[model samples]
Target: MGELVYGLLGRKLGHSWSVPIHTALGCAGYRLIELEPEELPAFLAREDIGGLNVTIPYKMDVMPLCDKIDDRAAAIGSVNTIVRRDGKLLAFNTDADGFCFMARRAGVDFHGGKVLVLGSGGASRTAVACARQLGAREVVVISRSGPDNYENLSRHADADIVVNTTPVGMYPGNGAAPVDLTAFPRCRGVLDVIYNPHRTALLLQAQALGIPCSDGLAMLVAQAKAAEEHFFSRSIPDGETERILSALRHETENIVLIGMPGCGKSTIGAALAALTGREAVDIDAEIERRAGCPIPEIFARGGETEFRALERQATAEAGKRTGCILLTGGGAVKTPENYGALRQNGRIYHLLREVGTLPTDGRPLSQGADLAAMWRERKPLYERFRDTVIDNNGPAEETAQAIWRDFCAYSGD
Candidate 1:
């Protein structure tokens, strides 16, 4: 046999967090394996195969290939984890355990709650099985062409819990909710299996309505932990799941700064990047780079409308990046579309400085503009966009340190 291989198998995995999650769980050999449909059989027949965690498009395809499948996996009709021992492939479904862990961590009580699972894929099956296992009173699967479909969502308006298994709001397609939570007056909790954005549109709406919600990171980590146990035939402490999740969030989440044009966002962003060892991206600067001109020049060329278009493009590109410090132009928040662009991979912090202290050197709108009036007009936007507010009234480094402290301590809750 050649060297044993262990990794995650998927069709497309550019955004997967499984590598880091498994590595944190002590699997040094863990990696991501992107395979086409035809490559599946040949890869599985390899003699050096050790263990693997399967993902979308392959979860059900590998079942018939497995020599034996645990009852749980058999019941769910899906297998996301496989262990190759004695020349036989053993299959198991760890996603069920992961779904349960995610719900419990978010305090989403499935006991007696009617669940509306969104999708008819492998992940949806896992959610349905786990919801039932957690004592869900009734579980309904809503699919595109099913009896209970998106077109007739009002019929399930009394659903107590909404679990999204589809990739509707996944990254690069961010902010597309599968169903409107407001339509479900009785929705007490929301669970989205897309972990990249950290907050799907469904979860955001749930948050707006004061409903409990959780992203899929916990489920991803928990499933990885369960897969690790199966790989090594050993038990891992439950505490390890949260520990790794926290560390991953701290490492991957972006620190975004948004506020008035001259509220020290750039200076504070640089300082925060220095403190946290993350790259600092100024959206205005990026726009200038793309436009090959300065901000004032851009405004001079095509007015506020043109500047905002460039700013929106810059925000979209910058927000797709992970673990960076993003500083936005003051007027960026005025455009409603910029919210999801920056929020896709960031925790926004609004920087506050005295209106009199704000500089207007090359800022077109701020130059001879009514500073106090600007503040009055933009305060609500800042408040609506910020996850936390930091006073830049203090030293830049001190403010940056404060932001670092908060970012580190934030639970992404």
Candidate 2:
């Protein structure tokens, strides 16, 4: 009926990638319905809805309206996907399968192992249920004031797997972690359900510790795939998830430009932003603003260590943002800690330019230093860290357009 309508039901529909995700799967009619609590009943009562995905503040609310509930959704106490089948709406918990997919992607097997989950909300339920389904021996549901809360978190040092269903490090509040992964030395894997920044501080820490870790992006895509299957009544190739995932990850993630000073990061970043309609940020400028002094003056007054501290702070601030073209200082990659901040929500592009041609007039390190030696030292790091390389030997606009074209191609925007 009525061309089969489908959409996402949420209180705040901003910053959702669901529509584009569904579009990628060849579903062109998806809409995002932002409904107040009172609005949900009438909306669910409508028979024309082909399917709907439930988000925060309404996942549990949509359950009672369903004619039938999937066992996993009932067990999880949440309904994230609703399909109107034969005029009767049936509820299902795709999050359960989604979390399972996330864990499996992280190489975390739940075969009678200790599992610690942060937050006892709707998302946590699926994580707990899925962990149990996969044969997790002990599933500790941590809450704010619960018995296994973050306060007494250290007591659970035996935790084999840690899952963060909390919003601790989700966007705006980036760089903050709920608990220290080092506390649980036995932790073999870590997972955070916050997909905005893609990689949370917890996941970064887990990665630093060489523990297998994954963010909520995989789960987000996997759940969307499951919902698509229910709506279209078709079996999708398992490999489809990965192709969509890679495209989404590259597109949704910010595009960061890293190179030596005067290698055209700022120029190319601004040009790229102009071409793509995305914002552009200069990390060196951000550092100077935070430090209340010129970058050259900061280097002169406080030494390179002081400048690095300010750079790290600025880098973390930039990490919280998404879809911006970030132009970072050449030496930003020297400090390994900055990698997490830069990579949390972006992909690095090494702006390769000839050392002799790079500007050095106002740059402190580049002005009198052996530019050749500096390039030789940072060259490998730039090459190793970059997801793509932008050769800035040509005109700035041309280089920027090249990057814009590639980004649009990868993201399909």
lDDT of 2 by residue, 92-130 (tens): 998887898988988998787999999988898888899
Q: How far off is residue 287 in model 2, in Å?
A: 6.5
- Strongest candidate by lDDT: 1
Which candidate has the top score in TM-score?
1
lDDT values, one for every candidate = 0.90, 0.86
Worst 10 residues of 1 by lDDT: 404-413
Q: Against the true structure, what is each candidate's TM-score?
A: 0.97, 0.81
